[model samples]
Target: MRVSRGVPSVRFVTALATVWGRAWGGSVSFDDEFGLFVCSGMRGGFARGGTTVGGVFLTRRPPTRALLRHESVHADQWARYGIGFAVRYLWEELRNPGSRNRFEIEAGLADGGYRAERGITRPDEP
Candidate 1:
């Protein structure tokens, strides 16, 4: 597990997310191991599995290890790209929705709970 210290601006965004998570009635806690603030039980205001803003992860429930692993990659992306990651991600998502998104591919489709459909053939059909 690589620990990511996002850039200053990204960290500031994370701090804001953390505060929002708490205000949204989520249980916020910093995980030293992952170096992320895990915010669970948010009433609303996230999409899909959850949302990771820099080092803060906001979710509706406790996350599975695979989901956390997927989200950690997003955190790394935020660190690498600073605050611009959000815009880049949106562009990528618009260009390639769902499993086709480059960031999602980089993060591992299976880990992110997306079906892997590249090379498997059904035994009966093929």
Candidate 2:
């Protein structure tokens, strides 16, 4: 699967996220470092950094470099799976929710900033 930005499927997802960001009063900005769309101040809804909708990363607070990196991993998953990413992700969520999911594990709990409260440690970690 070629995950090019020129693809129509990817473009459509980006457009959908743009509309959602606008509706939620979230400001969209492109992060050159991570090469993803960041939508900040997107509060009072299903809060998350995502790629299921598009290459859009939604957050209530300003996104950090690490956060963008975490979301970029999700975007890669979206590109790899295309429309099926959401379905597969949903299935995974049903099986394992939160930091326990394999996807979140691959994304890295610390890098994803979801480890702060959970106090998770990798098998290799001391």
Candidate 3:
């Protein structure tokens, strides 16, 4: 869920998928077939497979609309670039943990405006 809009600069570092899911009343889980890895920490993230796949270390998550949108992007990346791309993303991040890249910015922007222009700030900044 979203925190106090009345307060700004209260930054917290978390996975983009988790934040988006929480905003829509859900949580994130890691599954070999289906898990979410933020772009900041890695190039590609995985989500667990379901139905079509059988017992082969499958990872899965609950069904949620927010998750679909957020995670689908990762799925696309994996498909386009294959697993090697993901590996490289992870490698680079492991070398430097301070990298907050494009995905972070995009996620923040998507979640940023809500109560502000809508006049939801409690007697706050303009």
lDDT of each: 0.81, 0.68, 0.31
Better of 1 and 2 by lDDT: 1
Model 2 per-residue lDDT tens digits across residues 44-116 = 3444553325677766778777767777777777777776777887899889787876666666677787753
Clashes of each: 0, 0, 9
Model 3, global lDDT: 0.31
Q: By summed lDDT, which 10 consecutive residues of candidate 1 come out lowest?
A: 117-126
Error of 2 at 108 (Å): 1.7
Q: For this target, which candidate reaches the highest lDDT against the unseen true structure?
A: 1
Best by TM-score: 1
Ranking by TM-score: 1, 2, 3
| lDDT (Cα, tens digit) per residue for candidate 1, span 63-115 | 88787877888888899988999999999999978788888877877778888
Candidate 3 residue pairs in clash (backbone atoms < 3 Å): 31-59, 33-47, 33-48, 33-59, 34-47, 34-48, 35-46, 35-47, 48-59
TM-score, predicted candidate 3 vs. hidden true structure: 0.31
| Pairs of colliding residues, candidate 1 | none
Error of 3 at 99 (Å): 8.2
Rank order (by lDDT, best first): 1, 2, 3
* Model 3: CA > 4 A from native: 1-61, 95-126
After superposing all C-alphas onto the true structure, candidate 3 shows an RMSD in angstroms of 16.5
